[model samples]
Target: PSLSLSHSLSLFLFLSLSRSVLSPPASLIVSPDRSQFFEYESVSLSCEVQGNSARWRLKRSTVFGERSDCGRNWGKPQGSSCIVSLIPSHSGVYCCESGSGEHSNAVNITVHGDRVEEEGG
Candidate 1:
């Protein structure tokens, strides 16, 4: 009887853990399809969330190791999106995160300067 009870308890715990691990996470999609851009051009990083959320924000990481907090707001009933103007300095990986502790995959962006023409005027 003692051995049977222990086995049942162990089985219950294993099943519960498996369910938690296998459950699907909240869905989020970021757009402006390609992640690359030019130095002075404007780029908007937007995301759509599917599921419950408390809040969200757009975070950017520059190639020079600087981080900037672009925008943040309460999550909408149907999800939310934000657009940020791009400058030469705003080049690198960007992503979105929910205040409820959810984060989207990182999108790498490369911003470059225009080529200079060397000639006598």
Candidate 2:
């Protein structure tokens, strides 16, 4: 009986480790496949996983030190994709994260356009 219990415990640990090894982090897919954009342009980002894509959400960290999630403060979430309107101030790093705390690879996006400012005294 002692040996049977010990073997069962070992099998449980091995199965746990195997599950972790079998699941790879999701990947972020950017439509239009470019990192640079002009003002007024829109970008679509999606999360690619082996199973369900709905488990992930888009996230962004702007150059101004602001972080936002899709459908929360910035992009519009459409199904498994997030659509973002581009502006010069929207340049930042974007990625996908799952509710289980799994993070995908990140991409850096830069918006290039004129920033108009009035001369101040």
Candidate 3:
């Protein structure tokens, strides 16, 4: 299959950035390390970096809006993440931003089911 121009450009950019001297973009880390979660639980998404979090606000993309900043109404910004009170509506991709415009790679969060079983013994 032929790659669309937009897809080609995206691939090029992804490759260029991957090879660039710049550090890999920041990342969102989940405490449980599990993408799946039960409803009504607290899900914490922390950034890989510390310090200077004033520029950081959890970002989410939606079908209606390409991107939107997570508001304090849904969760409180603590340290490097927006600690959201997990609900089904919160299931989506999330990322963190810094003052320099360096945004972390997006992480997918799934909030559904009844309860999350602990991993490992």
Number of the top lDDT candidate: 2
Better of 1 and 3 by TM-score: 3
For 51-70, candidate 3 gives per-residue lDDT tens digits of: 45566667876433557675
As for candidate 2, its clashing pairs are none
**What TM-score should be assigned to candidate 2?**
0.72
Clashes of 1: 0
lDDT of 2 by residue, 76-100 (tens): 8888888988878879999988889
Give each model's whole-structure lDDT: 0.58, 0.84, 0.70
lDDT of 1 at 28: 33
lDDT of 1 at 60: 66
Query: Mind sharing the TM-score for model 1?
Result: 0.58
What is candidate 1's lDDT per residue for 26-120, written digit by digit as tens? 33344456666654555555554455544666666777777655643211222355555555566677776777655666778775566242222
- Candidate 3 minimal-lDDT segment of 10 residues: 112-121
Error in Å for residue 89 of model 3: 0.8
- Candidate closest to the true structure, highest TM-score: 2
TM-score of each: 0.58, 0.72, 0.61
